[model samples]
Target: MNAMVQSTVPASRTRLPRKERELQILDIAHARFAEHGFGAVTMDEVAAAAGVTKPLLYAYFGNKERLYSACMERAGDAMLAAVGAAVAAATGPSEALRDGLKAFFAFVDGDRDAWRVLFDETLPAGGELARAVAEYRDRLLALVAQTQLELIPEHSRERAATEVEALSNALLGASEALARWWLRTGALPAAEAADLLVATVEPGLQARAALRDRTASPSTPDRDQGAP
Candidate 1:
């Protein structure tokens, strides 16, 4: 059967889905926020960069704070999903950590601007935008804590849940500092950054995981138990 072939539309003129267009605008906004601080960036700037009218931009996000919040929310969602997918796809705990770190570094390297938006203090200290970024950070810490709970044996997890959560937060904080340094230095490859985290954490993680397994194992009964 013969079918009619549709002519290709120009990408520039193509009408993207609402969410897709929103993402396109956010990408430009991320770059703008990175170059100029969030406070300095304006809807006009984002609109011009995104090649959309100011009215269209406003229609999508309402106002500057909302627009910035949307960008941060999107960035966080993408980053968390990337690392979570990496961890879920791994065959084992250690491999999960490695893959997750690799995915994180990849995300950071791929979108340094987005990273800046998420972590940049130059944004308003108290506002909806700041709150959005903070919530993302809290979720990142929660992701670490939840992952630990999922992979550990129940017996060990019960005893160590609080300690593990605290450690997870500390580790995340250190990782964030190192990431900032990595960005500033600009010398380390993404793989090396990931390797640093895996090397630093894997041995301790494995040791604890081994302990969990041992603790959860059933003990053998004594041969003379009945004679006592």
Candidate 2:
């Protein structure tokens, strides 16, 4: 082909298909929503960054809140998948819990903005995004409860369930708090965060075991008389 003929071609006219354009908008919107809270980021800004107009952005997402919610839903789903897979691969409950915790901290460490949007209370209130976060949080609590039951002695299952719920809430709060702190200071590594959780949880588990033993032991009563 001649150089003049090649120059005459109109830049290949590359255009993204509809699905691709929608995905591109969502990608840009995800970054924006993560960096700026759901209420703070504007559709116009997302559209501008995505090289589309506001109407096109709306066509894909309907509104700002909907867009933010979709981004949050995606993040929540990803986090759940990672944690669930890690837990499933473990051989024991302790290892499963550790793996799940590691997955969560890993995500937080890698994507601080997503962590904040998913966790931070100041972002907004009463939305699909908040509901998604709550749903994931509940699922994690359930996993912790099941893991605790598995680790506990059969006779102590009832008490273990309650204690595990409390412990799970505490661990969740602590991990989230540490994550926020790390966002500002970058002091602790993700592995260190996992270690901290295990260090805190293991001793508690041992103590609970001792208590169960004390409670379940045969009482020194006048059983020789065979009184029912």
Candidate 3:
């Protein structure tokens, strides 16, 4: 009787748990958004692709904007976590930057769809969504700025904060641009891409540190003049 009752249970009754089903829907929606920009994808298409009814999808996510927001949040958090871990394990600021860049590129290479979702230019320009994206960017900016600050001498860090922030912004912007280019043209592998970025930026950073050192050093009196 128990076996018969189990056999008679409908497939819907045996559906995935709510959390699992939500993940499944998110995965499908992420891919769809990656392939087609935010403006192009429809919730119906996502529901069909995810093998869930539209009402069930709505029940899980509330609406398409929320769904896209969820995808972006997941991708952004994953990326930050990857870079943070890599940076934390590094021995020094230089290694931190290098490892962080490598981690960023690796994450993008491992999941290009997530990359697209996070970086899609077509995303709404102003709203809660925009603020959410900005918050992620700000977090990344803070991470990069912290690393850059370490490159400066401890005594000079206070005055150099603004400059370091600017440089961090530049590096972050360049990295994003390079990532987009890499996605469009797979010429360099992820590690090679990271190396290239480091090669291009490291020299300038080193030079800036040397300049700061020179500026911070006190001038010495010419004692040799009296001896001569």
Q: Model 3, 120: alpha-carbon shift in Å?
A: 0.7
Q: Is candidate 2 or candidate 3 better by TM-score?
A: 3
CA lDDT scores, all candidates in order: 0.81, 0.76, 0.90
Model 2 alpha-carbon drift over 4 Å, by segment: 1-14, 217-228
lDDT per residue as tens, model 1, 1-228: 123333353356568899899989988887788878777988888898888899999999999889878778877898999888998898876677778778888999998887887887787778787778778888888767766665677767888888788878877887788889899998799889889977988778768777878756667345568623
Per-residue lDDT of candidate 3, residues 9-70 (tens digit): 87774479899999989989998999998999999999888888899999999998899999
As for TM-score, the candidate ahead, 1 or 3, is: 3
Residue 171 in candidate 2, Cα distance off native in Å = 1.6
Instruction: Output the TM-score of candidate 3.
Output: 0.87
Could you tell me the lDDT of residue 49 within candidate 3?
A: 88
TM-score of candidate 2 to 2 decimals? 0.81
lDDT of model 1, residue 190: 86
Put the candidates in TM-score order, highest first: 3, 2, 1
Per-model TM against the reference: 0.77, 0.81, 0.87
Q: How many backbone clashes does candidate 3 have?
A: 0
Question: How many angstroms is residue 36 displaced in model 2 relative to the true structure, after the best TM-score fit?
Answer: 2.0
